[model samples]
Target: MGKWLLPESLADILPAEARRIEELRRLLLDLYRTYGYELVMPPLVEYLDSLLSASGGDMDLHTFKLVDQMSGRSLGIRADMTPQVTRIDAHLLNRAGTTRLCYCGSVLHTLPRGLWATREPLQIGAELYGHAGPEADIEVLQLALESVRRAGVADYRIDLSHLDVVRALLETDPAAAARADEIFNLLREKDVPGLAALGPDLAPATTQALQVLPTLYGDLDVLEKARAVLPALPRISQALDMLAALAKALPGVDIGIDLADVRSFNYHTGVVFAVYCGGWPNAVVRGGRYDDVGRVFGRARPATGFSLDLRELAGLLAPATASSAVRAPWGLEPDLAQAVRALRAAGQIVVQILPGHEHDQQEFVCDRELVLRNGAWRVEPLASAEPAARPSPSTAI
Candidate 1:
């Protein structure tokens, strides 16, 4: 095997893609900041129990576990950052009022989440803690849509689901409740046959509701259908009302409802959502209310946030163009050095060409050049043809 070869689902991000990812990261962090979200960077690895405390079984299966060398406790490479951020809010900061936190980092998954996905994803997201109202969910959801919008994703919609709806139906029958995990898997797959197979053990109403849930997807009309068909459980009605309220909150945006979307059943408690774009078969962003998550950290606060793999989101957009740069000659002369420093300080990408590498291709497109004219460096546009050729160090005045 080639020494440079990475594992099956892991690959290196090349220069172009890396630049795009970095740019998007900065843009998102800035967006979060404007909303008063303070940035927090949790370690890439932590004690297993604490790391998986709020993530549930799905995250547990994806996390890479190892024994700590010094402490001898089991440690895990985090597969998600939400729980870590939760711990920070619950234990570290312990702020009495609202705490808005955002994070961006790498998370290792045991396998690729999709056919073309990478095992190691650069996850970026924002979480809001200490508020349980629909307003918090509304704020987070709007920010999520704005994230992709600012990233240049024009065609996208948000699919909203509330876990409480499913939980309520299951609670009506002990047998259905006992087989909650299996039923959730079936619902996510939209496996009507499998759901029907469980009908013998489940109550007639529960069985009917479970089967009908899969078909209860599409636009706002699905909510009306749900009310008429599903059992008249208060929690179910409340969950449906919440979904309608969220859809109403975002009037211009495309919205969807999927009652059967229980993929995150174990993790979220209410109003779960996923943002989907045209080309990607998977959700680009996933988040929802997880009030119970903080409880595990000894501070049961209302928490809701969303995260997206920057790499995945970047893939959906057109490749970024090479940034325009200023070509400068490599030199130790005080004037030349000072000129280069000035351009750099002014937020320009100044590429200094070495003597031997004058004809080598550069990652940046040098649209302008720093030339010495009349004993002082001056900025001038390069000849149309000059930009294509490697910058010449000998051209230094």
Candidate 2:
């Protein structure tokens, strides 16, 4: 491979896409600030023990570990930013009431999630700490939806699930408890034959429940079908009720229920969801509640939030409208320099055409120019200049 060849599933985010991601980051961070989510930035690497303590269970496989020469203890590059932010919320802030926190940064995954996925993802998300009700869940859900909407993703959809439902069903049987891993895999794959293979050893009722999980997915009405089919256990019922409440809150919104949609992050204790956009084969965003993630840090708070790949979201957004530019001849004259600075400060894209250049200044789409017609620097529009095929000056940065 060439020296510049990037590893599979890892590529450079070029100028156009990088600018799009940066702009979206600013917009979403501002949105989070409005909701009282104070911004936080956790270190990219930390001691393996503190970094992975509780979440280390779910994150071990995805983390890249190395020995710290200074302490001789292992260190890990974070694969997920959630646990780090959780630690900060629990130990550093230690606020008594609810804490709203948000973060945006890059995380290094040991491997790509799928063939189409990136190993290094720009993860941006929000978390609500110290609140333990469906109310917080609803808030996070709304924020996640708004993120997609603001990105101009059309016809987006959401699929919601409660891990408690599956946990409730499994806790009922000793046999199911022993074979929990196998049962979980079978249900997730919706493998009826594999589940039936365990019928002789597993209870008939538990086997039946596991068999029905994969099919218990679809529109909101699927909840009705689930109520009729699944055992009328309190935990299961409670999970269903929460889903129903969300559906009611957002009428006509495309919401779905998938009882078997378990997340890889096992620390999550309650509701979980994945958001999708039109024509995408996989989810564009994902998150859920992980109340116990803070236990290792000595404070366990109810936390729910969603994270999306800024690069992916940027790719999904519609092309942004181009801004007109003012082409100015480069000079150190006080008036001209002041005009250039003023234009830029007032939010206009000003492209300064430099002096002593060996090349022609045909790069920018020069709609207007800073001219000195009346002794003072003045603004003038070009009479017959053709627009240049280039990215807006802002994006080029």
Candidate 3:
């Protein structure tokens, strides 16, 4: 085995991709700031129980656990940042009113989510705490859409669902409720035959409802079909209404409904959403309302937010063009140093050509040069076909 080889699902990000990821990170953090979202950076690892407080079983399976060297308590490498941010809101801050928090960091998954996915995802997102209304959901959803748009994804759609829709139907039958985990898995997989197999154990109405769920996906019209076919449970109606409200709130954006897509059924408590772009088979962004996720921290609050893997999102966009830079000769002279410092201070990418590396290909495209002209340093455009091995100036510093 090669010493440089990483694990099966993990790989290093190269210079170009890393630069793109960093730019996107700064842009998104700035976007969140404008919306009054304060940035919070939770540790990459924490005590297992606290870390998984609100994330539920799905995150538990993905988290990498180890025994703490000092505390001797089990610690986990976070697979998600939401719960940590939730804990911060609940315990650390303990504010009486709204708290808008955003975070960007690495999360380690036990395995790759898909064939072409990275196990270590650079997760970035914003969360709104202390609001339980549809307004917060709408706000976060809009921010999510804006995030992809700003990232240069022209065509994308958001698929919305409410866990309570499934929860409502399952509550009608104890058998169905008991097998909730199994049913959720089946629904996520859209396994109609598996759902049918459970019919003998569940009520006839529950069986019918479970089977129809996979098909209840499309535009807003799916909600109408749901009302027509599913049982007339009040909770189900309320869930459907909430979905309608979300769709109504965002008029111009492309929205979708998927009652059967219970990917994070256990983690999310209310209206959940996943954003999809054309190039990626998986949802680029996922989030929703998880009211009372902070309960485990002794302060349950209504919270909603969304996160996306910057690495994956960066992959969807076109490669970033090389940044233009100013080429300067390497010298310790005061004038040369001052000139370079001035350009750097003015927000320019200045690449100093080393004594022996003048002809070496660089990541940056040096469009301008700092040449000593008339006994003073001056900035001028480099000739397009400048010779790689051009002779140095006779009056070299």
| Rank list by lDDT | 1, 3, 2
RMSD of each: 2.8, 3.6, 3.4
Write the residue-wise lDDT of candidate 3 on 1-397 in tens digits. 9899989889898888999999999999999999999999999999998887677767878889999999999999999999999999999999999999999999999988875889999999999999999999999999999999999999899999999989998888999999999999999999999999998899999999999999999999999999999999999999999999999989998999999978877678998999999988888999999899899999989999999999999999999777777788999999999888888888878899989998888668777788998888877777762444232232222
Question: Model 3 scores what on Cα lDDT?
Answer: 0.90
Error of 2 at 315 (Å): 0.9
Clash numbers, per candidate:
0, 1, 0
Q: How would you encode candidate 2's per-residue C-alpha lDDT over 1-397 as one tens digit per residue?
A: 7899998889998656777888999999999898889999999999998877868387898999999999999999998898899999999999999999999999999988754789999999999988888889989999998888887787889999888888888788788888877877777677878988988887888888878888899998899999999999999999999889987877768998888887653677888899988766768899888886898999877788889889878877776544467778887888888888888887877888777662464434567677776567666665544655332322111
- Taking all chains together, the TM-score of candidate 3 against the true structure is 0.96
- Cα-based lDDT at residue 68, candidate 1: 100
* Residue runs of model 1 more than 4 Å from their true location after superposition: 384-397
- Which segments of model 2 are wrong by more than 4 Å? 320-322, 356-364, 384-397
lDDT of predicted model 2: 0.83
Query: Alpha-carbon error at 347 in model 1, in Å?
Result: 1.2
- By TM-score, the better pick of 1 and 2 is 1
